[model samples]
Target: MRYRPVAFGLAVAALAAVSLTTPAQAKPAASSTTMANTTSAGTTATRVVTAAIPFGQNGDIPVARNYSGDSRYEIAVFRPSNGTWYIRGVGAYKFGQNGDIPVPADFTGDGRAELALFRPSNGYWYVRGVGQFTWGQAGDVPVPANYIGDSRAEAAVFRPSTGKWWIRGTAAIAWGRSGDIPVPADYLGDSHADLGVFRPATAQWWVRGAATIAWGVNGDIPVPANWVGTAKADLAIFRPSTGAWNLRGTSPVTWGTNGDRPQPGNYAGDTGTDQVVWRPSNGTWYLRYRVPITPPPPPPPNCDPSYPTVCIPPPPPDLNCGDITYRNFKVIGTDPHHFDSDHDGIGCES
Candidate 1:
């Protein structure tokens, strides 16, 4: 979200609102996917696709495919909805759509949409949808590395419009390749390549590109990076709305050798963005990347018994609870009244 103030003849104006709308569809319920157990907080987590998605040529239509043997895919599930998606029939040399792209059982979103494929033989993997016949590699395209003739790249496409997802590519430290995408040549490139989309509870253009994006509760975007097989790689989610990326957490994978690449997919986890689900090459699911986590610092040690009142920082002088004496000036009484105004147990103006 980029905002700037403009000074006019006698007023200050904030430019806002670009109109773009999709034709109304029957309720999102009209074209919902069958979900077995979809209830939340005692209520039903109904599927809702409120916007018009230009998914290739099909728009809101759904399609299916099949696969063969000795082949594997990297699939990522949509958070909570409990859906799974993967890339099938991708050859090391080119892209083919003949294989099955299974839509997870619980996946009930607006058109069942997966990601575009990136086949090294063809140079790169382009994004394509159902309605459209050709892939749209013009603006955003992901180009990963090729290790030992086998492509070592992974990708997961969440609700792209959510603006909380990012792509990461890991190559051998020696594997150096720049991911190139088309940019406006004449624009002078004032913007950075860090781009993403987002969806807010009540805001327009939350789905931003090359801009700050944030997510709900555990909302986060995936980032692609090159990491070593032996060491762990730290990753931070980018917040486009604030132009800040934070080290919300880290991920470490036992990477393959120079020729081995990490397979990417959406892992099933607790139905929120706060949880991370990564599927390992063995097809087992993990809650986090294998790495040491730094536990939070221990709370300041209990005040020393001999010196009860020790000022911290502005550095309170050490005062002994046993030796510190208090004299009441404001209150006069036959009975002694101390500084413990609230009177919990301590007898001084603590």
Candidate 2:
């Protein structure tokens, strides 16, 4: 069909500003800025860049770059009132403000796209897909004994342990298939189960924090916070020395060393108030978050040179391909490059 790969980088940049205009009234021209350039490849290839441009006079709102691909775009919004941020994605043209926005991408090799959204009004995050779309709470969101100004909240994108997106907030993280109930004690990380790990064998949810805690059916444990979340489950790992966890995904549902064990926390918010806590023993104090199970790490990437080593060349070009190419291109211009063509998984993994 002789198709021209859309200008992904430019389009995402250009359109990002146009999408987030304030609805209250037409204000001054928003700030025009560039984010990063990304690359994608397949039968056809093109470059894609995602920019977070200021949309309103205050430039407080952020919209993800516009692009054409199986990839899903996520945007994090901040509310100045509470200094809180929230994220939502899964839709093509509009933001998934209340419900899950569905974007199609086979990030986990499951052959389907995952959609998620964070709703600050109710302090609940929602996920939708081929199977289910349900809402779960982020753990630490201070339901504030009293109402606050506008109840504004912000969010960030999260790939849940369930091989899907989980929104992080000032509260707890919720995960699992749509319609499936999430546990309170399992999720971890920023108040909202924004980032976490899952232990399939132990069925525990772990999160990165100053202390890194592991959440599971039995209880939560303390781990290193160096590990980051990734698209694949279980693949998330942590370093013993730096105490860093690799980016695997939010739902790291497996435990390696200790079966589900609880971590210690200060109930009265005092370091001196330190007390050992566990589930069932203190259910009210704990929150639950679902995570996708992951296979074990890939045998240390076969560092053994003696075995057959497959040499992988640098990645090919990224031809932004999809229906929104033209629409997104008009907005982005080709000047700076912000694309991750290598597809080693890390965006701009330079």
lDDT score of residue 162 within candidate 1: 27
Candidate 1 matches the true fold with a TM-score of: 0.22
Off by over 4 Å in 2: 1-67, 70-115, 120-134, 138-350
Question: What C-alpha lDDT, on a 0 to 100 scale, does residue 112 get in candidate 1?
Answer: 34
Residue 122 local lDDT, model 2: 46
The RMSD (Cα, Å) of candidate 2 is 25.2
> lDDT for each of the candidates?
0.25, 0.27
- lDDT per residue for candidate 1 within 96-172, as digits (tens), equals 23221322211112323333343233323332322112211223233222212222222322222221222333221
Per-model TM-score on C-alpha atoms: 0.22, 0.21
Can you give the lDDT of residue 262 in candidate 1?
26
In Å, residue 267's CA in model 2 sits off its true spot by: 42
Give per-model CA RMSD. 21.7, 25.2
Each model's backbone clash number:
35, 88
Off-target runs (Cα >4 Å) in candidate 1 are: 1-114, 117-130, 135-254, 257-261, 264-292, 299-308, 311-350
